[model samples]
Target: MTSLPKTMHAVAATGSVPLDDERALLDVELPLPELRPRDVLVEVAAVSVNPVDVKTRGRRAADAPPFVLGYDAAGTVVAVGSEVSLFAPGDEVFHAGVITRQGTNAEFHAVDERLVGRKPSTLSMAEAAAMPLTTITAWESLFDRFGLRADSTGTLLALAGAGGVGSILTQLARQLTGVTVITTASRPETQDWSRRMGAHHVVDHHGDLAASVLELAPGGVDRVFTPSTTGRVPLFAEIVRPFGSIVAIDEDPDMDLRVLKGKSIAWLWESMFTRGVYETPDMVGQHDLLNAAADLFDDGTLVTTLTHEISGLDAAGLREAHAIVASGRSIGKVVVAR
Candidate 1:
């Protein structure tokens, strides 16, 4: 067994504080995690920042203990619970852990075996860390929420295509499905990145989204996905074909979902943590999906989207990563590697 430390360093943010406040996140010491029957202990090698982390930090209560806020992680298994069947000590793995549990900003973390998968052998830990959350969300949104099949032939309109989930979503839609994908990218670099990720067409979100998409699809798109909860519900409604599906991961409190009623469009919300958060009967589906994604990576069907990497697992670095994500200008994923 690998020797374990009694305490580990982790970056955490106190709840309900503004994410832009540097004091919100701090480097702290946490006792090593105790594992559950289905858990595996991982010595975290790398972690990535996602919008969920910023949202979670902002929504936490002001008085709450510094909440560790990260989801995507890649590491080597240092220990495992007695009931863990899928992995053992020394296994290299990656996962987007359950939202109800403490996140993966720590040097060590414990995650349920069902929510984890073996890391793709071709990628480094930092590269693998950039994947789990966005990949799972993209996969779930594309196939599960939209009920899209690999043989499906249609056009998909992906909003904010340069963002973390959108980048991967565009790739999966292009490679896995027969869909002609049109991605929204405002900047020159991001537009290039979207095309490199396999988007058949790249449009500008800063301009008239519906008009841009109409020019590409002629009528409208058969599917739409937006990672951020922007007030683009009406735009999506305008460009989505009748009875088409629209999926999103962000919380849209102000969204008027009724607008889609005329076309009978299907509006779906996808949260990657839903399965683990609810302890659903098919929680193991995360394991299966992650393994399938790893296969895609190994076989060259998928690529890691990590464009920026922070060197240390500390509060300062975490805050920098968070700021980049909050800026909405990051082209791909940003990771913190130790």
Candidate 2:
């Protein structure tokens, strides 16, 4: 094992005490891990702020110091465990870690080799930082949960297409196969960007979402991806072909699911942590899926959707990131440099 660094820095929310001031992220020195055989320690280069981090901060009533929150990391490996053979000390890599552990806001992080993938050679660390969490979500929803054939020629309806996961999914569906991809974005800029990202058609998500989608894909879509919190997007079953699939990442259960019984729609809820949480048989799917994404990136088939960049992993910067996302209309991903 490599000698553990004596001290490292991370943006932390200290104390369980609740106050408006608690939102300020503080720099704190933390001890790096004593490496294990199968683990690799990465020197984080860039990180992205997701909605999960904001939710985590608000949930803590106390000054809960030491809560280092971040999920997505694009960085370079600096040390490896004895059993690790996939990467050496100089490889660039990325991964979105489980929700339970300390996150990627730190200058350094340790991850199991099984959970990480080589960064896309086509992208910089900032661009690669935007891919993992959202891409993992999109990949798992489209491929794993829906079981859509890699070569499926069906139409896919992406709800809130301008958001993080939807932006990536829209392009992935476009670049990977012959799927007729349609996405919803309310703003003018978002609509244009979604089209640029390869959505065959773009519609307003504000009005009756199903009706707007029906306008472009009147023939009926084969897949529905609920990437954002759209209570109405679940009605996509109405626009989807009978027996078509609905893959949802929305945690909110406000939809009238009772309407789907007649269509016999295949509804699936995708969570990237299912395998790591349950130790499922195909837990390594994340590793494989990310590698597949890297390949598409390298081949020029896929594009990076990094729209916004912020500096430092501090609470102020995180607040801005969350505000943009909470407004329900951000195109692509927002990254924060270490």
TM-score of each: 0.97, 0.90
The weakest ten consecutive residues by lDDT in model 2 span: 15-24
lDDT for each residue of candidate 2 in 171-269, tens digit (9 for 90 to 100)? 878876678898888889989988988899988867776777677777678888875645654466578888888887765666677677788887789
lDDT (10s digit) by residue, model 1, range 26-46 = 889999999999999999999
Which is the leading candidate under TM-score? 1
- Please state every model's RMSD to the true fold in angstroms: 1.3, 2.5
- lDDT score, candidate 1, position 260: 92
Model 1: worst 10 consecutive residues (lDDT sum): 14-23
Query: Model 2 Cα RMSD, Å?
Result: 2.5
In candidate 1, how many Å is residue 63 off? 1.9
Give residue 159's error in model 1 in angstroms.
0.6
The TM-score, computed over Cα atoms with residue i paired to residue i, of candidate 1 is: 0.97
Candidate 2: segments with Cα more than 4 A from true spot: 1-4, 14-24, 63-65, 254-256
Scored by lDDT, model 1 comes in at: 0.90
